[model samples]
Target: MIAANVSSSHGEKPRKPPVKVLSSQLREGKGSAVGGGKPEVSIRRLGSRRPGSSGSLAVSVVWMQGTVLEAHTDQNSALLLDETGNFHITGVKNIPRGKPCLSPGKYVMVMGVIQSHSPEPVLRAVKMADLSHNAAMHRKMWKYEVEDLQQTLPS
Candidate 1:
């Protein structure tokens, strides 16, 4: 099995923006996002591809936690950071009321769906959360994931 880190940190939380992955290089089940304030969900980067059950038009739900390395929100759509890669989120709720703007460098929990076969999949977020308040938990998750990845790597 392949593996990847789930959470991320740089000593303290990243003050600058998170990393931005070129959409062209991502494989599957990668990306991060969040909105408003909600409980954090344990999510990690995916290392295996789940074959599209039927054929095309397959949607996979992905839960991810990471910093928003970059973001741009219009009236109805936004793109969140690059844990493994960036995500283009559409039809997301909780616009932060007034500004409807979210800054980079904010930690978040993202649950979205992606087309299993799309090379550059856009994560249509269904649920999102601000996990910055629980920085310790997110950082600890990174350690566990790294351990998990090590175990999965081939000798």
Candidate 2:
């Protein structure tokens, strides 16, 4: 449902938001509900397509906090959705390992390297902290997290 009211080709007419549907959803007819029309989808990942191709191996570390929108996991790897994007996190290190340690709707703080810089950037999470799934608690946590993050910035 996230979209911008962009100007159309015919001048000034507000364009509709582009809806992206997962393949499974499309198969299940979920893609047809957007404004009673078929939703458009792109095959490639949504983010910066290229990383730094320069000779410099400089990797910048940063932190992000967002509600978990989606999650996927295997025996060795895990993915969790965030505002920037779904991050591919190393499942073994600094993560609470057990059945359902992370799930949809959990708030989390992740520290990682930006693999790409798109609106939904991909990050390789090095460490993470669970900020609880409660909205009130998460908001309180955000205040503290922001304050801590602010101190790290060169002001």
Best by TM-score: 1
Whose lDDT is greatest here?
1
Q: Give the Å error, residue 22, model 1.
A: 14
**Model 2 spans with C-alpha error above 4 angstroms:** 1-59, 75-100, 133-135, 140-144
Supply candidate 1's per-residue lDDT for 27. Answer: 50
Q: Candidate 2: worst 10 consecutive residues by lDDT? A: 24-33
lDDT by residue for model 2 (48-122), tens: 223432211112334556656556555444555543245444442445542254566767666654444333345
Residue-wise lDDT of candidate 1 within 1-155, one digit each (tens)?
54233343665432211221223323532333333322112222234423432111111345445566556555555655543455566555543431233457766766665533134446556567777788567845754553344234432
List pairs with backbone clashes in candidate 2: 84-120
Give me the displacement of residue 72 in model 2, in angstroms: 1.3
Q: List TM-score per model, in order.
A: 0.45, 0.43
| Model 1 TM-score relative to the real fold | 0.45
> Where is the poorest 10-residue window by lDDT in model 1?
14-23
